[model samples]
Target: MSRHPDLQKFLDRYFMVFLAGYFLSLYAMAGTFSLVWSTYCRDCSREINYPLSLGVLVVTLVTAHAAVVRGRDWGVWMVAALCIGSVVFLLPTYGFRPHMGIFLSIIVVALLALLVLNSKRYRAMRVLLAEYRNKRQVERASKAQRPKVRRSR
Candidate 1:
């Protein structure tokens, strides 16, 4: 039995859907916010765009999630990088400023991402997915190389 059967099931089924949906929803919300704030938001705001920033954030997080779900060690490190980058990108925007509450929430979200990434279930899912992929590739190669046979009718 696998250590993380549920995680493996989800990975095998709709990992891409979850990743894509989460990213698209985040971007859609950010874009909506930008449109609404364009007139009321007078602060310099660094002339930086919020939609793209959040979109990239979603990309990093989802990429990490996918990497982990697919049993890639590189993605494990990426999750950490995403957490660190989230702090760097969001700190100035939400930290030690007027909006202290927002900063805390962002920190919590980053922490949650790291927590999920490091979960035993997630790690187990990664291993299972790697083995499944290897098995599939091997089967495909063998089928392709198999010799054809025909009998007289």
Candidate 2:
């Protein structure tokens, strides 16, 4: 289960991709939320910003895949933080105007669904799980190597 040292560099590459995707998703999600919020505030009806939101969500999902492939803890945390932020941002601000919150909620659902089904995340998770197991094995092995105390005569 021990990964080759050589693979660390490759892992770094995927992690970088994941971070890039994370930032991109943030920008896109914020932009889409803003766009919908702005348009609805001005027009007083649901506009067609779903496509733009979906596009950004798609990118974010793909980046989620990259993170899974790398098995990065920070990546998972980043995704979790994003989801939490979306929920926070999507909350209704005023009693009369709630379209923006609605729009954000819909996109959050879509993004969450995508994250659940993401294949890349699964692969990366596998690798990460293996790494954890390997580390555990090494710890056990080291413990076993320690000399036992002699019995008293």
Candidate 3:
């Protein structure tokens, strides 16, 4: 047997880690919003923004799936961009009254981003994914070039 690590297993574990971190950060954001909205924004007449939350969740999940399952680098970059965008956009929304939950979420996301960016295993998985794709392509090409053999009508 080859000594290389199993790519599927590694990806599965990585995805689990990503999910845990993502949900933790999401919980922090939700809790903070709940507390702040109740304390200060009760009279603002603003309802919870479900569309934005759903959009964020969908985008995050798709990018994570692409990165972990499809081994696409763009997915990783998208995740990073999302993280940075959240920090950039959210900080100013409070108008100099940032909550602890926002900070907590930011810190969690930052750590998650660091792990995604710095993991040697992820790098190795990318290489492996490329190699796997190349092998599949070669196999398809060779099969296409071969003459079809019909043994019996």
List the candidates ranked by lDDT, beginning with the highest. Answer: 3, 1, 2
Give per-residue lDDT, candidate 3, residue 54.
Answer: 53
**Tens-digit lDDT string for candidate 2 (46-105):** 456555566766676567555645444455555655655555554544334546665655
lDDT of 1 by residue, 41-107 (tens): 5353735665565567567667765765655678768766655555555545532243455455655
Using TM-score as the yardstick, the better of models 2 and 3 is 3
Each prediction's Cα lDDT score? 0.57, 0.56, 0.58
By summed lDDT, the worst window of 10 consecutive residues in model 2 runs over 87-96
Misplaced by over 4 Å in model 3 are 1-53, 56-60, 94-98
Q: Which of 1 and 3 is the better model by lDDT?
A: 3
Top of the candidates by lDDT? 3
Error of 1 at 26 (Å): 6.7
Task: Please write out the lDDT profile of model 3 over residues 2-30, one tens digit for every residue.
Answer: 43477567556555555654564454345
Which candidate do you rate higher for TM-score, 1 or 2? 1
**Model 3 residue 73 CA deviation in Å:** 2.3
Task: List candidate 2 segments past 4 Å from native.
Answer: 1-32, 35-65, 94-96, 100-153
